[model samples]
Target: MAGARVDPPVHGDPATLGGYELIGRLASGGMGRIYLARSAEGQLVAVKTLLAEGVVSDVERRRFAREVELAQRIDSAFTARVRDADPQAELPWMAIDYIAAPPLSELVRTAGVLPASAVQWLAAGTAEALVTLHGEGIIHRDLKPQNILLPLPGPRVIDFGISHANDLTRTSLTLGTIAFTSPEQARGEPSTEASDVYSLGATLFHLALGRPPYRADSDTLGLLAQVQRGQLDLDGLPKELTALIRPCLAVDPGRRPVPAEMLARFRQSLAGLPVSQGGRRWLPQRWTDLIGAYERHGRDLARGAGIGAGATAEGITVDQRTGMVPPPEPTRVYTQERERAERERAERERAERERAERERAERERAEKERVERERALLAQERLREREWQQELERRKAENKDRERAEEKARERAARARARQHASGPSSASAGAASGTSRPSSRPDPARTPPPAPAPSKASSAVVWLVALAVAALLVLWLATWV
Candidate 1:
């Protein structure tokens, strides 16, 4: 049946599948197609259908069956529960509990990477799922953001089609989305628990940065190459999460922390955290009130001081032309002191602001320097990688040439031997007598050849010679100056 454009296709007319009523297609993938189905008992279940043509080979069919059976065995609150399966059937299919929730990809697309609280919740939920999967010795090889469903209670990990059970070498399934694949996976290694962790790190990186860690023009290979070499920019990420994700995305799988351990650490990092721990609290009302009060108080203070400067304490008006009654000594002293304090405070504030500005400038300068350094390092790494690839290509070409030359030499040697044998046989047939060989004196051993300097050695000698000549010239100039 043709599936709808909408993700997790809506329910439709009933079509029977192994006595169960097929309602509609939920999702379609390369491995199989999922359909919303209802059983005889009227319980809704998701049925996955494997195409006959798709599983033409026995190995492919067995692999499909194993996936279904394995998925059925695993059960977790954070994971979609597999209800039943018929692996041996002509058209293999598996049924799982129907979960009603939008995938994380859709949610994030609709409402940008969720608020910090939501992100924390997402992390916690996914961590729990990982813990369950790890305990069962199962690695969800394809742990992309889309596979994670955001339900009302929490996040639920779905689509275990590419999951490996216990023995990593048992399956050769090329699992995982390109953008989220770990370095090892890119290098053609099987996905391990650490691979899942790397994927989580990639997802989190996307959540924080609003983009993947690596940006590339081409497909998976380009992203894989970037992943193999790219460094995460922690400046754009929250300082707390940066440390956690760094090890998760480490190029070496052995370096990443276990799922449970990572979860525990993340929880510990977030436990009892104040709203202002990261930065300014999001208190719009309080901010508005403070601003309003400051403006009102400043205006009132200015007006009062202005009026008091000209008016007498006894309600009598003072004249400026004639020497009028001067303002009270106490008031004048207070005003002068207040003005002086105000000026001092303003100066202090200005100095503080200047210092902050200078510090910010220094930070910008340092940041620029760091970026340049990182860019240089990345460039150097790329250059080295390119050089290594080129060297390999050259070596391969040289080996091919050497092989051809050896084959030609061998053929020529064989022809020469045959010619010599034919000539000796013909001579024997002609009754030619053998001649006695005369012993010749061996030539004197050649004189020991001088060792040639290496390129590096030659360059060094040239440099040293130039330096010595320069020193001599300087010495001559010094003597002339003297």
Candidate 2:
């Protein structure tokens, strides 16, 4: 492949596209320009924008958006990988990996024509890329040498599915594009997968013979006519390369080999060649040297631009190959979001703590209430015990009082019995004495003087009765005292 055609930024270019810093211009066309830009991570990317010169209409924006969609669908290593895009941007743009290889057009110009083996290798690589592109139902309407880049690994197809829908409408189908235009595209017919095959054949023809299939020095109308008629000069092509490439240049799109078939044919033809052990041995040494120079130049440009030279805040190292820096670990927006989440978590924890504290306090309060209730019960029990003891003491005192009253009554009864017995005996003795005296005074019964002796006896009896009365009174007083 040829060296990259990197140009310095002009006045019309923007400083940045889709947040990528535009360091240089890669290429430009009627619709827009492809800029060599650096990402936030310092990785080099080619950013294509829709703002060419005039006010970008809605139709143009939609077309550019479609281009981004088509480009994104291609996931093969043989194609430029899309990095980022913003179809809704004011100036809609798409970013792709900045391949550090030159186009086959420039390569052929600088290093002269490639040998048969090298050409076959180029054809095989491009055919494989076409297989991938066609598999996605995409036809590279503008497949030309300028769109094919040859890096170390393999050939990379760039600028696929751009603004080809408007190709026929636009009046700026330049000489560079018309040579590779398929007969169907030249005749204003819808270009199909087979159209891409025709274009590939024309492109390979250029690589081999160092000129387009059709002479470009002719007028535009005549060139279009020649392409429409499939009038090509393949006279100077090598005998071995002719059989494989000649069928591709057939006027009928049906006769042209499919990309897969073309890939198989090329691989089979170059099967006897020595295997390229991870180097660009399929290319001449001079071409390989140019590829190295281009790679070194890209590295130097990255260093000079100071792209992704330091570690990210996340401590992830920058990519050494592309000088690509990863996204910042904590952007301002992300930091704010994180802080909000942290605050929420802290609030939740605080609520949980408060709930736990409330539960603990409630338990403590319940425990205290239980203790107080037990104490009150105990106090009531003690008061009941005291009342019972008082009642028992009062009962004991009443029993003693009853017992003393009974004893006093018994003593009083005994005293009264003894007094009665004593009085009876005294009365009986007096009567006996009176009886003896009466017998002696019986002789003088008739006499009046016998009354005097009886008077003494009566007096004695009266005294005895008085004494018994006094004793009975004393006994009553003693019973009262007791």
Candidate 3:
């Protein structure tokens, strides 16, 4: 309805909130600024971020987080739906439906006062919104016209700035806009359902007559004092609305009627009107046409621009409009942690390399031992061959000695045979003379023991056998040493 309160982003403004790209400034207030953003899926949303300065205390943060919970609990068609929020974010923020509707303030300020039938429609919708909100144990402490949106479907109550549970007596905040504020809130008392009701009455009065019920001067203190006085000035208001809206502005909180009762009263007051004859075609003709044109234009714009149409984003783009987000945070970081992880990885690789080297060294040592054993075996074989050659040589030497001894024995035997033959046959005289001459020169051979030569041969053979045995024993000892 009213054009976006669009402004260029200033220096030091975050390019994105959580993840939604902040395209334009909607409106800035004491709490924070609202931004127009498009989600990844192309839906528009109004992102409200709390002022970093105002978010100093844990007490205030808890209170804000509590209000966020209240906003989430309300799921009514008459109010803007909360899409996302993170109370523990860097700066606390929330994303709500971006209803392309003008505020009641803008509508009234532009078009003066609403007709009685149009006001009934608005009242009915607002009362229904209040009923839904109140049913969920929530009170919209700030229900001024600026917070009320006039969309095609109906009025969508937005901005749960100071909403709280009715059961809680004290709020973290103690003040509100004085003109629309209830007497209790102006007196610094706790907000209640009755307080919200009174604000609704004041909002309705302003919608009906183009001004709030009470005002002395426009100063904050003066307006607050007038609200504390609990006075109403509905001089030229329609006769049907006096009874319904008057009780809502009661001085005592108990005297104010609940939203359901007021909704019934407004319904009864609008019963006789011709516009109320229709089920939902009850809006004035000018407003109906206006709403229709607004919707058609919205559709045409959507079709033309695609999903993310609102942003004329200049710088960095971060689309978080799908409403999905990563995990809030780990019990968690960047350079230092990454470096630590890198160090750990490097250490693991080094350990792996060391283990591989150890295995390689062990294999090499085992191979060396095998080579040494092979060398030892080759040396032992060579020693056995040398010992065999020495044994053969010693056997050949013993054979040669045996052969010479045999020849000497054979010669001695030949001489004995010749003597026996002489003794037995001829040359007895020669034999006797030789014998007498040789007696002094040599000892005479014993002819009876003729096997002495054989005996010597046997001794020679025994010596050869012993020499072979010794060679074999030497070979065995050498093998053992090797």
RMSD of every candidate to native, in Å, equals: 38.5, 31.2, 31.3
> lDDT of all predictions, in order shown?
0.58, 0.72, 0.66
Q: What is the overall TM-score of model 3 with all chains considered together?
A: 0.54
Clashing pairs in 2: 2-102, 2-107, 3-102, 41-325
Q: Scored by Cα lDDT, where does model 2 land?
A: 0.72
lDDT for each residue of candidate 1 in 92-174, tens digit (9 for 90 to 100): 76777655444555444444554444455567678788888777777877676667755455567875533344432232222
Residues 279-365 of candidate 2 have per-residue lDDT tens digits of 377778887887776677667666643233231111111111111211222222211354665576589789999999999999999
**What local lDDT does model 3 show for residue 225?**
67
| TM-score for each of the candidates | 0.50, 0.58, 0.54
* lDDT at 271, model 2: 65
The 10-residue segment of model 2 with minimum total lDDT is 311-320
- Write the residue-wise lDDT of candidate 3 on 8-100 in tens digits: 567987888776777656555444567777677777777877666744567656765865787788788888888898988768888877776
Better of 1 and 2 by lDDT: 2
Clashing pairs in 3: 39-321, 40-321
